[model samples]
Target: MPDLGETYACVPSTERGRGILISGDPKSDTILYTNGRSVLMLDLNNPLNVSVYGEHAYPATVARYSPNGEWIASADASGTVRIWGARNDHVLKKEFKVLSGRIDDLQWSPDGMRIVASGDGKGKSFVRAFMWDSGTNVGEFDGHSRRVLSCAFKPTRPFRIVTCGEDFLVNFYEGPPFKFKLSHRDHSNFVNCVRFSPDGSKFISVSSDKKGIVYDGKTGEKIGELSSDDGHKGSIYAVSWSPDSKQVLTVSADKSAKVWEIENSNGKLKKTLTCPGSGGLDDMLVGCLWQNDHLVTVSLGGTISIFSASDLDKAPLQLSGHMKNVTSLVVLKSNPRFILSSSYDGLIVKWIQGIGYGGKLQRKENSQIKCLAAVEEEIVTSGFDNKIWRVSLHGDQCGDANSVDVGSQPKDLSLAILSPELALVTTDSGIVMLHGTKVVSTINVGFAVTASAIAPDGSEAIIGGQDGKLHVYSVQGDSLVEELVLEKHQGAISVIRYSPDFSMFATGDVNREAIVWDRVSREVKLKNMLYHTARINCLAWSPSSTMVATGSLDTCVIIYEIDKPASSRITIKGAHLGGVYGLAFTDDSTVVSSGEDACIRVWRLTPQ
Candidate 1:
């Protein structure tokens, strides 16, 4: 599938993309963040077992845990609110479309019965309050002329709600059917972050104009500013309250996260946490959340850092990964120790077992990669930029990449590993032959061949056409000679895979059907394996040549053992939170997969 529209638009790091959103699960040492289009649930205690929640159709902007700790409310750029069980398998219990534009922030009431979703809603309400279960509008958020950037509910009884918006005003509301109380306009510019104290006696709001003001949580009366002197030199993006409500934490573009003692009318700086990074104000802090004494901070690069009282100067632990949807995945046959993955942002990450998150593939423009073929020495890639890149593989460095013009952009590539010499490229118009980065020849099969595969010995070339016909051709010299046509599929063929042994092959179609063919006998249908309920996206062969793994749009990964074809099929339904788009086997015991969920997972098939 192509990159989704308008979801991943690029803007300045300070104004666009995902902000450093971190929500702490009151139940434990967990922190939630938006990993591209999905949410990542990270446990500070374990750190390695990162569980992901990936059901959103659009980019998720903010997520918050209900005070009761039993539910989570998340909002997307498309103004959709989803309330699902936090500990009960995350099944959606309620969904609401409260606004017309993007939702920038979400918060739940202390009773966990009410939720307030705030966003641009350019043409409609800037914010709204509703019943959590019934989606009934409980109150209106008035007095904001622009987008409401953030909202919070007072934690204690006399129920109160506070919202900060781009209008440089903070609106306070007073219950089940909340009413607008008043507006606190101390800030001179766009207000970004606002939060209520744990005790509900006080609240704080920060603005891009460097103002941090606290107010009486109950009456919406302005108490005093955080620092009476000037304000933050840079924009204050987020803030949090300590468990005891005595200290307030804030992160800002000034490249620091600090703690302030909450005095009666004013605040004093207690400690400053150091964030280590370089490049374009690399340490520019964006978002923060307090997990007990532990402070979690998010950087502009999507790196999460943990800081505590004992070691307030440093972040002892951090986790990093792709910040966009993974578009393609491939493993080098010559060196299977590392796996390479490409995302919608044109970022290519190299993942190793011991080390994590290797840097992106070095490209001048970093266009969206269309197809990738990897060998031990180099990785060949083609993308929408209409250029082919030959990258020298050296662990995660990606050494040196040479970009060459490929007249027409290629859609897919087939690496003939069995022969280890030929690489076939498929474009909309025809197919091209590449002999180690150099285009040697072209074959005009003419009918829009969408998928292609090379025979094990590199002697036969198979192409799947839009007409649902599999065209078999002999690879002689440079051009192809059509030998036969197999038509058993009723829809366009999506993927075709040649078995390692070259005895048989498999082809899957858009109609959710997969078929096994005999190469030696040239039979169109050797076996009909029909179990998936959605379109088969990609297929891979096991190292043993007996098992074929098929990834589909239905989110299932099925392994077909040719011995029994139908009965020996093992299905891993919902193998991925979203549809699987790519599959590859690193060895006989391990198969790696990545899909729309923006996650790469490994399924082990070794002995128990």
Candidate 2:
């Protein structure tokens, strides 16, 4: 096995609609957030640099750092909580089944010795508190008739607990052996979140009723509600208190995050950070956290916007990335600085180096984007919805997207390197040739088309079928004329690619075999490139056309050189946590891979 050196990684973004808890370490400049089955630790200073902990077997719901910042408590949809080391190397210390259903939120006590896990527990209690190490019961969280949504532990002495839930109630608990004290019904609708002030003097609760109510932290008594005359026009999803406990911030589905100053019992509006857009679904603010001097809020589209607490009038620095599995990746030949990626969900992001998102293509009904190709000044994308989209590459129209129905789902898309206006698409029923988003020709190749490739000169095309055959065709004006059908593969062909210089081509199949073939002779150049244990999902050819790389379902990447066709292959085991689905070479020594984990990693290869 060869050592895999990683140069950069872009982790998955927070999911939409859900109010994910963002926990910041009190002792460091790191924040913890959950996505799918992984817990991610992101550095605040360099947001792109992230460390992933992929131990959770179920969809992770919430994660929190201990007060001492030595350990982290993370929970999943299965209601299991795992305490692990706070260091980049996540070593599990202990595990406990705290609830029967999903755990929506987690909170650690000020001393870092106890935790409260709360959410919907089908037949059991909605909230539970226990010692961090021993898992011994420390308190009882009772009296909520519905699922709990949020929980908070007071940061000072005479520890107190506050929780809000779908039942429209706020429950308070007290003591080392904490017991339920009382419940406050101040909101008209479901309570969405609850948080204690840093000073432990007061707490605030926000709800679907579009109201924010303050309460005495110790006695569970109601204080005056925050002035709502000019407040949120939509449900308030999250609330965070300032470090000094004198102010609070609330984010709402109305596309706004507002900061308020607390004056005795009432809060007055101070500043507003409105989401920039047309106030659509993607602009809805879902989660927020006030850690140190940063005011962070996550949108329904999974963009994390950070603002300076002391200067809310300034435009926020937004972090944008994918929150779902990336299905396709293509670099713009006209502008290498922009890399375009499409995901399982209909998100098309144009990434610029160092910056998160240079721009984004308008989403198409939230369908799955299956394949992507760069054609001239436009981006062509095929989707699970059997539709093709064309997007502009420059100026103010960069995000505008126009679509056309292809009648059947497309499996793959390939661009003709020299012919900028030509592209080839493989569909379930047949092969479709496009001249810049316009269907030039459609050929029912008499078999199930699984993969395809087009020649750089647009003079020929190759279609791979499930029957282990490659049908070669000559491009004639607006149609494909069959040249010959080669039968060499033993399994369904999964991917096909022509070398950049058009000297040779490579094909991978479901049987995990990669074969390099001579273009002119149509003979096998390397037939024994078989090291993968699972189906090959993607393949990329080096710029010099001397080496080929293949990514497989076994979560490994193999680089095979044409010179040493038999013995000198380099292997990168576990290149992606999940199976790798997309692979591309930026140059001769750099490759980028994206996978089921929704993370895109750049690897620096030193092939010996």
Candidate 3:
């Protein structure tokens, strides 16, 4: 409701394990990648024009652009394959349950009418081919006893399919109801990737044996092999061919991606791509793709590095963000450029709007962060680890950080900047008052805490509890003494936020009900203001203090105007791929939010 569209997008795809899909061709500058539950299409020429098709029921594992470029064939973890129109209309052409397990890889034929998919399916650990528009079986895949890891289609006709699997074998197939043509026992370890060159004259495969083999695309004869001695220090994971079918890009577990110039130039070491101190073994470069002028590689740390032919050794654009469920985000009024967000994976990152990723702030808790608040030079966060952490923005300039253990798991945090020494922590045990890493006092609410907010004056504190009740307490310097209880909600309270001007406060409950109450008297101002149909997850107030925005499980964000209460509501349904979990207001009213979709979107409100 606040905005018609998103201004800028924070691109961060979840690196679930090793299956990172980057599919595209040289002619078309756009490359498709899986981000959260949606398939992202980003134009190499115009990165800002990222299109997200997010109707997948399960997390997407593989996405392939049809040869015709008019259709998209995608497979998910649920073993379901969906062929949909590529025009963003979400027109479903066909759906097929190709396997009973995760689909590891899928590719469309050169003709673009049929697709072959394979993975760790039930006992049917074989590749299967079917027509794109109608779920008609086109062929069968066999010879691999273990899970099929990757598959590729020969681009220039004669219709050939190559598949590699955990059985350490590569099988070539041919025909309409495809039959096995030849089985090559080339790798000593599990084969990880199988890819065909653009010319269809040869193909390549890499395996966990730390080797990569090139083969004749038509005859299935091994042509060459990239040895472990000089190829890669660690096992190879993926292989992608250049558009001209002259160069091959291979990513490995050794934290490097290499390009081998073949054909006209003979076998030569073209270049080496490495991020010296990016990380340890955990930051293995797992996926690589070549798109015309640039090459994109993914790191195990979920970092995307784009390299150009002009500068092969140095990656030009390295995009970094978050990769798990974003739990909390805070944007400070003073440092408008810095945006801080914490995730369920115990990750905390500081983002600069104009730049990419700024830096990282460490957290003591090892669990999901519930709430975060910024104070002058310090940032305080509470988490499911039952602890309150004091994080310094810049440790050298700010004070050192400290952690206070709460008896019960903390769920939310509320800080009154006016009383810098006081921190209000909501836990399943009760509402605790902490004075600089020490518990001043606690008031047991007898219910689990969901959300909390402190008055601008720091004199009163309101906590939303699991029992759908509001527990109001009078703040006495460092402790909170229970004052009263408001029990109008029928469901657990999800969010509570005080207006910027302290004139009113809003509480959103799980029942999709959001109520605005008078801050001074704690009396309901807007009762039964219901626009959402699902559980409310987050709520934020506009900088001007006249409007309130709420995000819910319904995948919608609704903004309510205070002055024009009755009819001043704007609704942006399906605002996020999944339900919205965290929302923060930017300086210029750009509502930044993160959700199950694993993407952080900045919606630019169309001025009303």
Candidate 4:
């Protein structure tokens, strides 16, 4: 059986013209962000090390750590707030239904006793303050005419709460049973973010009009504005104060993050860190955080840019990966270090274990890649654009080369074991065999082929159909000759895989059933390995062919041993926040899995 080991979490999801939130722990160097119902915590020292907390049922929007660093309060799109432990297993403490719409931001009081959440609501108020344990109302939010975008709390004595909104206003509140004190209309456009300095003596607000204002923390009195000569050229989305309260950082849509020095009740630009990109929409900087000596920002493409607080002249170190659901994964046999993965939006990223993303493969068009097949020197891929591309691999680098258009959409791709260059592609109309870069033969099977696999000897192949039938064929001169038809599955076959040693094969269907068949007898060798409750998304055989693993849409991963097929099985529930999509065995004792959560996880197999 296998146990979960390390997880490589994706970057925070971002949107245009909106503020993205990232919170840092008060006691440690970890920062938190939300993506697809999961809150990810990444260590500042080692960006590859990550932790995922996935108890939220709806899409998570914002999360914040308590002042004591003992608890975390996270909210979702359904306006549900959940408080959980910060250590051990991260157990849930309480759950509350706060509003009717999306929660944009949340903050904890200086004493870690109460929490305030603000966002878009229906007929009810968009802001609410309640006790941490009992969910009792502690304060009211009453000054915004539209959606509240951000919120903050005073860090010193005489508690105060501040909120900014699309109404172009910043509201101030005071007390335990807090009441609205005043509303400051300083910006001519929507206010995106508000934050109080660490010393609780000053606060700052940034808006879409390319303006930032400093105010008196206690009396809500207007102080001074940031220097406009060197200010942001586009809308500012987020602001963060340094730990010492002498400096602040702001990220804007102009693809830059600037550091400002606060002196004499005014702010002046100290340095500017411009993100390097192609000037596309993905280059927009949406969120930022300054904790300890590290400054982190996230772009709309989900890349995390990290900068040093003492020096902003050098280029920032970037962390990049897939931002959407992963659909296909392939591990090269020649070198196991290079891993290639494709997402739903046709983006492909190559990753090296422990070192992070290496580079990306350029797609010819906007079409999802269905499957990938690897050889010794090149990799083959089939896409929804009805074309096959060959990517040449040299040492650790790979790039796209020649491509040929198939007649129909390709569903699956497989390569011959003896002759790796011989590839077979299953399509809606038939099967197409390609030798090198040209289509050698095309066979119209007259059925919708869903999946296919080739034998290691390059002598036989099996094609699965949507009608729950398997057609066996013999390879003869780049053509498939039909032999027999087998009917055991009740639903469409989604995946078919053969063991590395080629002793047996496995088939999984949409009805959540998997069967292992003996190659010689062509009969069911194991049928009781059916514990998944939803569609089986992927399956993998260990390198030694001792065990098989299956990933499902039910958010579970199950491992079945070949010797004790019926009794010895390990079920890992909630393996991913969303459904699992791809699985690949790195070695006999290790496997890598990816899913709709946009994260890649590695598991270690141990003998039980």
Candidate 5:
């Protein structure tokens, strides 16, 4: 039960990481489209429960509800787009294979009868307009010099369309046999997003060059330019126009959303909305939509922020949940308030200490977390999913964790005491040692050890098994010593830890009991039922060896002092919203804990 905060926020997609945001009818309530394999429709009014639809073979890049609100169209990396009736349980209407490469963006015609899809590949990126019902190509707008990033059809048109691309040009087209009418090259960098105003009189485009331009929809002439100096400091990724067409909204990599008045006033900035989440300019604002006067923006961190144009100063509501599952967790050595988590879908998130809560750094499209080991310098994570991740505090800013992958899926992992040396992973089938990215040794265990721990001196190692046995091995040779086997619990042992002095060892059971043993005599000194309601998942001993902390499925933490009996120890109830999966004591007084609730909690222990 790893905390989700660390793993998800750290590994995110660059362009499509931020999920598509849609608006409900004319009600102004937002509709969020998210998920890796399926399309999830989240209502902004509820924000908690969601409606899911469309099981795709690949991850979805974008989804849009039909203009009439009767259908939804979604595209994926496989160049497939599916149209579904959005009203009745999202029934599938039609599926089409439009391109050979990734489908970047899609838009339904104002009448909800046609779809326009664009993308890039071997040849020129194609913008093909198709009839939704028949999957027949209606027209093709084929003059983009590079991959197309976005495309949209004018709301009221004798069939007018706009397409933006990596070539930094916004191409305008017209007709049922759509032909390129004009190409606006005002954007300095890749034009990321473009949309025609509701009235079809104006169009707005955003780019990676930290600028946005408002152009006449018909003439394709740039009328106004919004620069970083006008309140944005980073690349602008998305732009939207208000319903009345008098205001424009833009989201940027600057981590803020700004609204500009289209009225004839010396071009002054109107409203600026800073994201509520704690992130710097690099946390990209990638998706946005304006429904009525309310503005909704989405970031690379997976959190959606909503603001009202009328009240920019008020704090916006934030949405949080997992689009994936947790994989691993590692506690920081220097800062008990910080923890790293990785997910099965390859997302990494960093949790930092805060007043009543903690801040998070979520990266999208990261490799899955495989194994985790904490050291003084950083927390290292390796995955069968093919990635070696590092969360370091000294070098780069504590914004997002970085990762690299070795050749294969990591079966097991451990860190060596020696600098620049990494231990090779051994599997349950065979015991092998990998050093310097190469296999060095192979040994066989009578029974497979699922979990292992290296001694502080690096001279000895202890491996635990599913057979309820502990095998102690000497690092110098393959020889092993069978330690005392105390068989009180009926289930397999989940976790084991050695004290700082190596004099005492603790073993937790699947039945929620902990047994403290004297290492030399191999005698069980204490048998404590710490969690009566749930199984114990992890255990940790204080640095001073005065107390022991145990995390359990009951969502509670208990501190057992060596001098005090287990029954009389201090208990911290409700330590995590979900079952606590891991715990670490940085010192005698500070403890860090992570769990399935997607949160890491830090507590201070004093003589009370």
Candidate 6:
């Protein structure tokens, strides 16, 4: 038998979001789900590869395997539910509208004969059990005054069902006719999840009130309430019983997961696992599941941390990919071994060094990164969500990304090595020179800047803005001496990069052009319309500065030579199935790009 942890295709929660649940078929060794717009069937035993489920109009919220393990049912924020066969050769079995609001959860009957329950958002919540074979409604259970959160049906004979919602009621129903039996209002807050034990002896309910309760399987009567004196500190989001029913595991917003011993006189907590909370906005624990003997926890920042009940010292494994839109990427200059990425939802992932490129990913603090710049052994990231973060790369145990408040939203950043004595950072509001953590000087740019870059020598810096012009500022003494406004692009400049020797610099614009300028004269040496079909997302200069690479919204990567015409550049079409969003050039011959496809592709360039 495969370990239950092996069946999760994708874990969506982030460090601050919630605890993660690893759900799928251990029998098939497959975790069926979706990543972004594509559905995927991942082989948990061998996670390096996966099968794609193509594209959807919106991002997927939940995916589950049918009881017979023949089909997968998935729902999205658009309230669209799709049923597709599990086999790669199978086709779409059904596609239908479930609600006008976001679908929170969906479940199929144990026999795979029908999809018993589905729910949507807010006051529009509806519980309708439908026949799968005929695609017809069988029964409707209604009474909740708020959004339905979770629903489940009994696995065995009695055919009883239960649902919990924002109305703070756990409603019970009996029969194939499915009538409301009773509504329990013991919880003070929203009920998030409900599930029955595998043997149908008991059912577990978790709520935002920070409590987990056990109920009798035969009747809806409460058996016992589990409290934080047992180890949890915040609202519990999810709960699952051990396969043998000996223990119950609950994930909480307090940044911990607790395991409770059921046979004890008071239902004692056997162990408590404290998850390292991400500073900034990434502190929520959202989802969790007990898979086989291991406890799998997920957070809002998209970190999947796996722990063993037997060994409490450390997590055995951690998995990470995408939980939201990837916004920025930076490759280490000295070592092409690692890549740093920032997501729109405020997750920073370090794709570490390794062979076959299957290196591990380390998620940093849970805050949206606005800009990132690497200096020597430290990587500094600024967030519009507030706080400037500094992360060290000197330790064996990956150092946590630590943040400090700079009292303003940093819109852009650039690093310059000024005579081995100073380093500077340019922001939307001002220019700041740093000596370690202390700010030595500040120059107000007086405009909302969007892009910035430092010359190779670090003596000069340029800031671009919504004003459609570039401001060249020369660092002198402790302040900016003066500013020169250069030729403006038709649209705002999005990114800027300098040549290795500081002799030249390039700025990428929203108008799909990359303008290269001479360092001393500030003369426009070249103007290349690299992305004719779409906006240029990013641009990277090769190590020698002889070649430049640009990624665009057209899902293509174009390599341009300084000496060649823009029409004669080398273009790799479909560099990413979706539009390329980030680009990094490793040395003079290699380039890497990450796209909306959630993949980073490496390409080798040769001078022609």
State which candidate has the highest lDDT: 4
Tell me how far the alpha carbon of residue 230 in candidate 3 is from the true structure, in angstroms, after superposition: 2.1
**How does residue 478 of candidate 2 score in lDDT?**
84
Tens digit per residue, CA lDDT, model 4, 126-174:
8999998999999877888898989898999899999998999999999
Scored by lDDT, model 3 comes in at 0.77
Clashes within 3 Å, all models in order: 0, 0, 5, 0, 23, 21
In order, what lDDT does every prediction score? 0.77, 0.82, 0.77, 0.86, 0.66, 0.68
User: In model 4, where do residues sit more than 4 Å from their true spots?
Assistant: 362-366, 395-398
* Model 3 C-alpha lDDT per residue in residues 236-271, reported as the tens digit of each score: 888888888888888888888888887542346677
**Cα lDDT tens digits for candidate 2, 1-608:** 44333423343345454566677874677888877887888777677667778788898888988888888899999999999998857889999999999998989999999999899989579999999999999877779888999999988889988899988999999987889999988788878889999899999999989999999887879986888877999889899999999999999988899999989869899988886665788888888889888898888777778888978887888777677777677766566555677787877776665554665676535567788877557777788888887776664145567776777888888878787678788888898888776888888888888999999998888899898898889999988999988888889999999998898989999989889989999998988888899999999888789889999999888888887864678887777777888887767886767777777766677757
Q: Which pairs clash (backbone N, Cα, C closer than 3 Å) in model 4? A: none
Q: What is the lDDT of residue 326 in candidate 1?
A: 64
Candidate 3 residue pairs that clash:
1-570, 1-572, 3-605, 139-177, 139-178
Question: Residues 1-608, candidate 1, lDDT per residue (tens digit)?
Answer: 11111111111122342244568786777777675567666676665556666678887777888877777788888899887777767988888897899888888888888888888887679999998889999887778889898999898989999998889999999866888889978889889889998889999998887678999988889988787453467788889988889888888888777888889858888887766665455467788888786787877766566788556765446555555556677777656757788766677777664444444556555677877777677777788887777778665566777776667878778877765457888888889887767778877887988899888678988999889999999999887899999988988999988987788899998888888888889774336777888889988888678778888999888777676746567777676656888788777667777777667777767432
Candidate 5 lDDT tens digits, 1-608: 21212211111133442223343455425473645554656555554334555367777767888886777788888888988877686778889888887787888888888889887644744678999999988876877878888898888867788898788888988888788888888878888888888888888787887777778777767788764467577667778888888778888777888888775411347888888665753356877888765678878756667787677788877654343434355666566556665555554555554422133444332446656666666656676655566555442244346654454555556555443244535455545554444455656676655555555555555666666666666676433344434555555566777777877878776767777877777777776655546877778888888788888888788878876777877677766544677687756887776565444456678674
Error (Å) of candidate 5 at residue 530 is: 32
How good is model 4 by TM-score?
Answer: 0.95
- After TM-score superposition, what is the CA distance of residue 601 in candidate 5 from its true location, in Å? 21
Q: What TM-score does each of the candidates earn?
A: 0.86, 0.94, 0.93, 0.95, 0.59, 0.75
Off by over 4 Å in 2: 1-18, 363-368, 399-404, 565-567
- TM-score comparison, 1 vs 2, better candidate: 2
lDDT of 4 at 221: 87
lDDT of 6 at 162: 86
